[model samples]
Target: MQRVLSCFFALFLGLVPLASADVEVKAPDVLVRDVTNEVLEIVRKDRAIQAGDTQRVFGLVQDKVLPHFNFRRMTMLAVGRDWRNATPEQQGRLVDAFQTLLVRTYSNALTQYRDQVIEFRPVRQTAADTTVQVRTEVRQSGAQPIGIDYTLEKTEKGWKVFDVVVAGVSLVTNYRGSFGDEIRAGGIDGLIRSLEEKNRSLETPQGAK
Candidate 1:
């Protein structure tokens, strides 16, 4: 009985970290350095970011970060099978909502920057001109290290991140099941409502920010 209980508790703790674990992500030399340095500078230099002006900070994210990411793919993945059901207009709305949610999320995350050190690894790219993986490590003061891996696809403009792996888990992949649950329950609209509620909570001053 005691052993079984202990095993269950251990499994729960593992899930805690696994669900939101900030793994030490490693990136390629120049790319990792450039990204970390840019974010760090924004944290240090941006007045609105320092002041917790999330609206403006998110505006910056729209300009700076969003351009580097692949929102269409991300949106499609998040919406899951609902994608097949939605009209083009509904799909567009879902994409916009998710993009806003992510931009605001990064803005908030950036505001929490105390001091994080990072190490970049070599870039292992594929022969095809379509994809590449950039890895990096985020070292904090006293917490377990976080690993971040960026999966990039080459576009006409430049490289765009389609997925970000925190620890070894893919962010989009992790969200899929939960998102699917919402889609199953409330459909795409339900998922949108949930995301809106979550974003609203972020706008409020409180926990785990």
Candidate 2:
């Protein structure tokens, strides 16, 4: 698993320490804690996990992460020029499959959450534009703290996190080029097939190890 993903998971694996649950939730703190808590609450009790109660990890990922993401925009960015050629149905399937792939990836990496702590940096703003960067630090006991920044855009409902940058790498940027290559190699269906194939090989993340 990638360090960025691992670091973020360690900070937000959702298992409330019980003692920490009653404390008042606040921003930077709440942003990191709440999302992690929401993710953990469902997976801890889910029976679908492969082992150590990881079966329902994918569902939990979809429920929590998907609600705050823009799959359509993600797909469009990933598909690049191929987006104009795909039919509405094809576009929909591609979005669904891509979403599944992401969920599975999260499920597989859930166990990477270790005994790490998180600190959210203040929201940075350079302009009045609707988009801004929200940053956080994932702190480890004996290791360096990893910086993870969420790129958020204002939506009709509220702020939605569209992309994540860990270290210097952008999750959306990393996948976008590859997805575009897939479209170029096999067309839209081929990309969809690739996503489905990867999802099939998914290993359920279990235990807290």
How does candidate 1 score on lDDT?
0.60
- All candidates: CA RMSD in angstroms? 9.9, 5.6
lDDT of each: 0.60, 0.64
lDDT of 2 by residue, 94-206 (tens): 88987777666666666444345656676655545577677777676888878877776766644556667787677777787888888789988888898888888875445
Question: What are the models' TM-scores?
Answer: 0.76, 0.75
Candidate 1 local lDDT, 1-209, one digit each (tens): 22222221111111111111122232223444555566565466766556666666555556555655788898887667778897787788778877776666665665555556666777766557467777766676887666676777766655567777777777677678888998889987888788878777767343225
Which predicted model would earn the best TM-score? 1
**Candidate 2 clashing pairs?**
48-55, 49-54, 49-55
Candidate 2: where is the Cα deviation over 4 Å? 1-3, 6-51, 125-129, 203-209
Q: Which of the numbered candidates is closest to the native, going by highest lDDT?
A: 2
